[model samples]
Target: MGIHDLPHALAVHLFFTLSSVVIGLVLGVTLGILLSRKPKLSNVVLPILSVFNTVPGIVFIGLLLLIWGMEAITVLVALGIYATFPILKNTYAGLISVNPQYIEAAKGCGMSQTQQLFRVELPLALPTIIGGLRMSTVYTVSWAVLASMIGQGGLGEFIYAGISANDNGLILLGAIPAAVLAFVLGSLVDLLQTYTVPKGLRKRGSTK
Candidate 1:
């Protein structure tokens, strides 16, 4: 392809990355919260998730491709599943890590279980959850390149073409933008972590 194709390719790449990440974030956080309420179930489920997480993105995508037959859904499902793991694991860890004192304090105030989760636990856990989002966003951007394998259209087109043609320049065209996109998104997540941190925690950190 030529330089002119870059804009469309980039747009397609963004669609795949953002859509899958959104799907993953919602599913991961929801499952994490539900599992957090049942530590025993989490013990079984989380270990299974970790095993699945060990699978490579390319292999995951290829398996989905066989089932879905080269559709965009195939790519989205593969990418979304990959994106879900980090967010789910981190959200679970963050929720469970909340200090017992906080839980006790909330209970002392007669706070409902739901209120304690929303008002206390979730706010405190936001930083760790955002960290998972950062991981998912960056990894999804890289994995979005696999879209080209099924002719779904993305920066990967340039990457695969470059490899076949033995042209490093073409490969860089895809790679550079992907790296920059991941950096920009990851930085945004960092900003989110900063603002979402509880004021008490911030004060404690500042004093130290």
Candidate 2:
């Protein structure tokens, strides 16, 4: 492929990465909140999800393809699930890690459970939760390339086509952009942490 084709491929790559990350983030954060509220659920749910995480990306995609067929939904769902684990773990940890003192303080202020969660807990958890998002985004960028294996077409098209043709330039063209894209997206997430995290916790880490 030439420079002209790169734009279309990049769009496809972004679609695969962004769509998956968005779904994963929402689901993960919601699940995390539930797990924190009912810690016992983690004992049952986490291990099962962990098993899914351990599965190789390609194998997972292939399995999903059997059910969803060689369709875009298959790739989106596979990549989204792949992206969910870290965020879910971090969100739960961040929420539960809040100090008892803080919880008591909020309660003393007459803040209800939901009020405490939104105004105090989630704000404090921002740093760690943002870190999870960064991880998920970077990983999905690499994984999204797998979209091409099933004909969805992303940078993987170049990578795989280059491999078959033994063309180093084509391989580098694909690999470099993907690596750069991952780094750029990760950096953006870093910038986001400053704005997302509570100002109080910016310097002093959140306590347990």
Candidate 3:
């Protein structure tokens, strides 16, 4: 791959990473909320998720490829599911970890279950939730490279090509950008937490 191929590859990589992470965030957080409300269900469900989470990304993608026949949806579904585990686990943890007193206070103030969750629980959980999002984003970037294996296109084209030719330049072309992409995306999540997390919670999270 030439330098000219870099932009398109980067764009494709970003597309896979961002799109999958967004899908995972929505699915994870939604399931997490439901699971938090049902602790017994969470106990059963979370362990199952953990088992799936241990599957290697390449193996997962390859399994998906067999079922879907190298479609972009295969890549998206694989990466998206891989991205979901951390977010789902953390969201459940964060929500359950919210102070019981706050729940009582919200109840005393006439907040409904939904109101208490949106107004208090989610806000308090923002820091932990964001932490999971950061992990998902960074991880998905690396996993997105597998797209090239299926010919869906990403920086992985450069990486795999480099490996075939033993060309370090080509490998660096992909590796550097991927590393930078992960760092940049991870930092954006941190910045998001700074603004979205409550000040007191941010301080407390920082201390921990």
Candidate 4:
């Protein structure tokens, strides 16, 4: 079936992908900010996140299945876990990369703590954060395919059926759209960076 005919499948994929990205971003950024404020936490959290990142995606899904037993929630939770590390690492890196002098200047200008975060720190860190978000998006979309193993409808259904039935055309139908979706998402993120990044930062090659 074409993607249009599989609206529930599409919606499931979209929900899983979007929810993973958003949750990953929120958790990642929050933890990243906390780490920046407390370098001692880095010795603890960074290693843990790194270990999680090293775990294979399928293994994570399998563990989730063992706990949740083939539910839709298992799919989302697995995908979300897979989506998190990149955003977390990158957000921490971005915030840390901000020059001390720039922060001092903001303080010199009497910017409040909230104002400094929103206007100075976040704007400066946006490119890196977005880059992490792009990575999470691709990861989430790809991982959502595994949801079909648990009886959730997605493009993976076509892939699984195609493989079982030896239908090359059906396999291509799923593979093609998945590839296109990833490409489109990556390109859209690039476009966002181009337009949304501060002009000076873009000119300085910091936005890329």
Candidate 5:
């Protein structure tokens, strides 16, 4: 790899990781909130999405490439869909598990369902949701590497080339950066959890 390659690889990796997560978070959290409003719907939809998640990443991306061709969008869509699952599940889980007392209190304050959802349930659910984000971010970093397989650029090119040439050094050049990126992104999400979650709710936060 050229000395200049690392910076370019880093940029590509971050773009893929962050972009997919942003798109995924919007779709996932929206679906999750919709499902949370209807237990029966969550039961049906969540299971279907979970089944999709069971498909291997490469296989899924390969299938998408047939329709989308070898563009970055194909990779982004696959990664976004993959990243959505945990966040959707956690959002539903977190909102459902909010204390009944809090719900009652929100009602007592004359808050409507929407207001209560925005102000009370979501704030309480922030830690769990952010935990899911951390998971998605880390997982997306790993998955983004596969983008190189389809001609989209990332550290995967280095790894794939290293494998082709049977050189560990080249593989490390790719892998070590990917690992550091995942760790750093995951850590940032954790730090976000502390800030985004309300200070009062922070003490009471529980994924359960």
Candidate 6:
């Protein structure tokens, strides 16, 4: 493959990564919030999510293929599952880690539950929540490449094709770009955390 083909492969990787991360973040954050409000439910739900996290990525891919066949949905579902745990776990931690004093003060001021969540808790938890999203993005991007095994082209296609053809240059072409992409994206997440986090929280090293 030429340098021109590299962009196409990179686009595939980006598409899968972005799709899976968005879906995973929405589901994970929503579930995390719901679970945080109901600790008893978390007792049952967190463990299941933890198990999903523990499952090997390759095995998860195999399971997806078995259920969904060798389709794009298999790759999307597998990547989404892989991306879910970090966001969910981090969101829960962030919510639970909120200062009881602040919550109590909000309650004393007669803030409604919705107001407390939107105005106080979520703002305070924003940094940690973003941290989870960063982790999920990195993980999703890296793994989405593997979807090429099922004919969904990405950087992994280059790596796999290179291996089959015994072309080190081709492998390096794919590998180097992927690593660079991950670094750039991770840095962007850090930049976002730096700017979006509250000033006091940023000072405490929680944001940056």
Ten contiguous residues with the weakest lDDT in model 4: 1-10
Highest-lDDT candidate:
3
Across residues 1-208, which tens digit of lDDT does each residue of candidate 2 receive? 7777999999999999999999999999999999999978888998898898999999999999999899999999999998998999899888898877888999999999999999888887878888889999999999999999999999999999899999999998899999999999999998888777767778875544
Error of 1 at 88 (Å): 0.4
In candidate 2, residue 13 scores what lDDT?
A: 99
Q: Candidate 1 vs candidate 2: which has greater TM-score?
A: 2
Task: Tell me model 1's lDDT, rounded to 2 decimals.
Answer: 0.90
The candidates, ranked best first by lDDT, are 3, 2, 1, 5, 6, 4
Model 6 per-residue lDDT tens digits across residues 105-171: 9999999999999888888889889999999998888898789888888999889888999999989
Whole-model lDDT values for every prediction: 0.90, 0.91, 0.92, 0.82, 0.89, 0.87
- Per-prediction TM-score, please? 0.95, 0.96, 0.97, 0.90, 0.96, 0.94
Score candidate 3 by TM-score against the native.
0.97
lDDT of 1 by residue, 1-208 (tens): 9779999999999999999999999999999899999999999999999999998888988888889989999999999999999999888988998888989999999999999999988887777788899999999999999999999999999999999999999999998988898899889888877887887876652211
> What TM-score, to 2 decimals, does candidate 2 have?
0.96
Quality of model 6 by C-alpha lDDT:
0.87
lDDT of 3 by residue, 87-182 (tens): 998899999988888889999999999999999989888788899999999999999999999999999999999999999999999999999999
- The 10 consecutive residues of candidate 1 with the worst lDDT sum are 199-208
Better of 2 and 6 by TM-score: 2
Clashing pairs in 1: none
| Residue-level lDDT tens digits of model 4 in 1-208 | 6555456766677788888888888888888888877888898989988888888888888898899898888888888777878888888888888988889999999999889888988889988988998998887788888888788878788788789999998787777777777788788888988988888898774632
